[model samples]
Every structure is written in structure tokens, then in C-alpha cells.
Target: MEKKCINCSQRFNCRDSYISWLFFIIGLIAAIAIRSVTFLMELGDIYAKIAWYLGVGGFFIFFVYKFRINHRRSRFIKANKLMEKVSGRLELKERDYEWIGSLLCSLSAKKERINYFVIFGLSALALVIAIYMDFVR
Candidate 1:
């Protein structure tokens, strides 16, 4: 079934939250695999291995959380916009809607960037610890 936007009365394809959930699950599995490989390879001492596993897992979990938040926010924004447009109380131009959509999308993208940096910072710290243990020990 086609989904209608709440603000703009525009009919467009909508993403299923289930798909996002699936992605999160897949990421978790990938994180586990990475940790397993690190353990098997004996990349470092026990502490270092633990650090690597935590780094990878934490990164994936952060990514999933950020993705889910942005996805839901965009969906809600789009739905609200569609509803506004269909109700015809405000009489917005097509360009106006386009601009608003672009603005919202960009904001979401910015949020992703912020989240990624935070994740990267944590992962980097973990990696540094692993490296120190492996080489500086």
C-alpha cells in the first residue's frame, strides 16, 4: 500500500521500521563476528582482545541507534508534511515543500555525522588501548 505524507498530501514509498530492526540485528551479528575473529587471531593479550571486541561492538551499536533515530524522525516529519499539504489550510507552494524536505533531510544527515564522530571517538580509544597492549607492552 502506498503511504501518504501527512504534511504535503504527497504519496510516496515509506520505509518499514521492521527493515531497520533487521539491519540493527545484522549489525549486532557482524559485531560479534568481528570480536570472534579478534579472539581467534590472538591479535593481542586478553585485555587487548577484550578492548577490540568492545570497540567493534560499541561502534556497531552506536551506528544502529543513530540510524534508527534518524529514520524515525524523517518518517514522522514526512508524514506531518503530507498531512499539512493535503489539508490545504496553509497553501504552500511545491518549492516550499521541497525546501522543507531538503532542510529536514540535511538536519538528519548532520545528526548522523555527530553520532558517527562520537562512536569513532570511543572506538579510537579502545583501539589505542589494544595497540598499546600489543606493542608497548
Candidate 2:
């Protein structure tokens, strides 16, 4: 909500976060297309094998990094919203606001506990996808 905190001088923007999300989607799409093409190509050929490793492996790394960046950016944006609300109630100085924002952001960033059933469900879906894509072709 607040672009900049007057007390802490910390700034937050959604533009970077949105950009990271966009890149993540685009990267995922490109990776899937590359994998599909590779699957269709002759596995005996060396070039196709190289493409398989590079395309899929590079995409996996890129996806993880971008996901982390987006996660942190989301936390930063949440912290800004918190600073906006709490600043009105406290007569704190710059350092105090900074400390409060950091503390709140850290607390907010922790993920809720995930059920093992959900994990199992997603894994099952992934297995189905792999079976269909590889064998049903």
C-alpha cells in the first residue's frame, strides 16, 4: 500500500514482484515446449540428448531461483503494508520502524504446515502426467 516508509526509509514496489512472476510463467512454458520437442526427437542423436539435458536442467534451476525471488518480494510487500498500519499508532524513530518491519516480515514469511496428503496428491498428478506424455505418445 505504502510506497515508502517515512520513518524507516524502506521502499516497496509490486512491479518487481509482478515481473518475476511473469518470467516464471514464461520460463515454465518454454521449458515444457522444449521438453516436448526433445521427447519427439530421436533419442539416438547426440544433439537431441544434449538439448534434453540443457533445456530441462536449465529450466529447473531458473524456476527455483525465480520462485525464491518472488517469495521474498511478496514478503517485502507484506511488510510495507504492515508498516503503513503500525506507523500511525507508534511514535517511533527510523530504526524502530525498520526493526518492527523486519520482525513482522520475518514472522509473516513462514509458511503454514502443509498436509502430507496434498503432497502425495501432487506427486500422483505428476506421475500421471509423465506416464501420459512419455508412453501415450
- Could you tell me every candidate's TM-score relative to the true structure? 0.35, 0.34
| The best candidate in terms of TM-score | 1
Instruction: Encode model 2's per-residue lDDT on 1-137: one tens digit a residue.
Output: 55643322243421235654555555554455444443446444666566566657756866677578669766865756655657567466676566566555534431211223433554466567668767886
- Candidates' C-alpha lDDT: 0.56, 0.53
The runs of at least 3 residues in candidate 1 whose Cα sits more than 4 Å from the true structure, single-residue gaps closed, are: 1-16, 43-122
Per-residue lDDT of 113 in model 1: 62
Q: What is the lDDT of residue 18 in candidate 1?
A: 75
TM match of model 2 to true structure:
0.34
Estimate the TM-score for candidate 1.
0.35
Give per-candidate clash totals.
13, 0
